[model samples]
Target: MKTEEVLQHVTTPLVNPAFAPVVPRFTDREYLNIVYRTDEAALRAVVPEPLEIEEPLVRFEVMKMGDVSGYGPYTESGQAIPVTFDGERGEYLHAMYLDNFPATASGREVSAYPKTIGSPSLFADNGALVGTLDYGSQRVATATMGYKHHVLDLAEAAAQITVPTFMLKFVPGYDGAPRVAELVRTEITDVVVKQAWAGPARLQLFEHVLAPLADLPVREIVSASHILTDLTLAPVKPVHDYLKGVRS
Candidate 1:
């Protein structure tokens, strides 16, 4: 193929040379987020330096994307740890497991989202919003929240969604060392929360070698929320590039 032909192809070049739009807007999404207090030491251990952990908090969410623009329907479950950077508080994406590969590839390449292939699901059970994650034959995490228990303040929730989120992007070098090491940040925009609810919830993370969610043991279930929203994810930008000694 000629140079121009190769450059025109979409989703091919593992890492794009220049910024090209890769939009995957979600229209209908059902979300369940469970916040829990975790081991203080574990919370501190994974949080990178300069990113402070004010609360021993970890949030596990299971979302079902109904109508995605580029990608089809898929489910995702993951954990985010509450952290602060340079006095700005936000959540740092720790790990994410999804059922779709296309979304997985784009998320990693575009946003540095730590997405891996796994069986994560979201459904209703006994009138509660249920989220589960399974790795092969082992079930690693399960969360259940009371469905639409209390009306949530949409304005407050929208503000929360606008907060900057962080992720660690690492592209290995030829020798298996990190070629690109960066702390990336991204925001969710054009968010319209059609409905929201809050209620009690429960979470359990089983021990598994592949999905070691139990590494951060759940100490207490703080709260849970079920939300329906339409939103777009903004392109990710690097907040810190370790190799280049850049920080912002």
Candidate 2:
């Protein structure tokens, strides 16, 4: 069906209300990662002994994710957007939580991760050692190193927001430990949503809430997933409390 028709078909409830435009997002992640652990002996075997090994021991722990929360904008909007997480929904706000806009944030909070591959070689006596590897007499060490990314994927409550904004993070320092590395923001140049139904418990706020917005940077938007946590790394105070300050 046409987009307009689909929008038109949506119905409404009866109560026109005004609740806070904020909610809580709780994100718990069991992020599995690889950490590099090197030693003096190993360091001494990469390059010609006598070179300073800027970065030594290295390992890449493939990443895995575990989620366990159900934060959403339900309490505020009262419109169930329907977000399904972990193969199911209903008990949580997964079915109804849509998306967010950290990408549009000018501050652009960053996260880091780790590096994977490396190349090592042995140097000769009296051989000049350059580059980042450590070297000493009677020993070889590693040289230039980096990560060979497997792949990157994105998904949320229900349908994967195919175009959800994102960025890659790498481990900081020369160590390459998976910290909240470089962050990727979608750079939301503009946005527009049209809602057209509502009532009381019996109310619909589809249009009243989503319309009249255009070309807006996504960062300002505290989204449904804001209450979902990790997706939206909020400030120290809970998102709801922050909202209170905004509208107060």
Candidate 3:
């Protein structure tokens, strides 16, 4: 490829990219989210600077992708910590583990999503909604909620899902030095909340050295939501550059 063609390339593997360039639109995307309180000191240790923690809260989420524009379907589970950026409340994405490679690749490379490969699933078992995450053969986290016991207001559910999300993007150079370090932000837009509900819920995080989700250690189950929606993820934009003043 010519130099001009290389400059125009959107992602790596110039000839054949891992994922398409089109922004993915999720149809019938399902989410099982449990917000709980955790250790304050532990939250401080994980949450980076420039972001302030409002409460010792963590949202454990398990998402089932019914259909995506370019990547088809996949399951993802992770945690986000409630924080404030520039006095605005938001959630900082701490960890994400999914089952698809293309989605994983694009999430980490094309955008600043903290995505990795793992086995995560969400389904209805009997009268309960079950979400679980497994690293290799060991279980990391499990969350169970009453399957749509009480109706949740559509506006409230939409606001919960559309909150600003922050993520840290870090890349190392070939010389094993810091190449890119920045805080990126994004939010879901054009949301159509098809269904939403709230019910009793419980969460358990097992001690896993690899996944380390248990590090947060759920203290109390604050609330739980089961939301189904069709939405599009807004493009990520860098909000804070960690190495801005240091770089020459």
Q: What TM-score do all the candidates reach, one by one? A: 0.92, 0.16, 0.97
Q: Which candidate tops TM-score? A: 3
Candidate 2 regions off by >4 Å? 1-28, 38-248
Order the candidate numbers by lDDT, best to worst: 3, 1, 2
Task: Show where candidate 3 strays beyond 4 Å.
Answer: none
Colliding residue pairs in candidate 1 = none
User: Using alpha carbons, what is the TM-score of model 3?
Assistant: 0.97
**Model 3 lDDT on a 0 to 1 scale:** 0.95
lDDT of each: 0.85, 0.21, 0.95
Instruction: Identify the candidate with maximal lDDT.
Output: 3
Ranked by TM-score, top first: 3, 1, 2
lDDT of 2 by residue, 1-48 (tens): 577755643122213211212322323321111123334453344322
User: lDDT: which is higher, 1 or 2?
Assistant: 1
Winner of 1 and 2 under TM-score: 1
Over 1-248, each residue of candidate 1 has an lDDT whose tens digit, in order, gives: 77897776656653643323458788878888888999999888888876888889998989899888777889998899888887888889999999887888878876799999999898888888889999987899999888788999988667655678999988897988788998988889889999888998999999998888899999999988888899999888888778775422
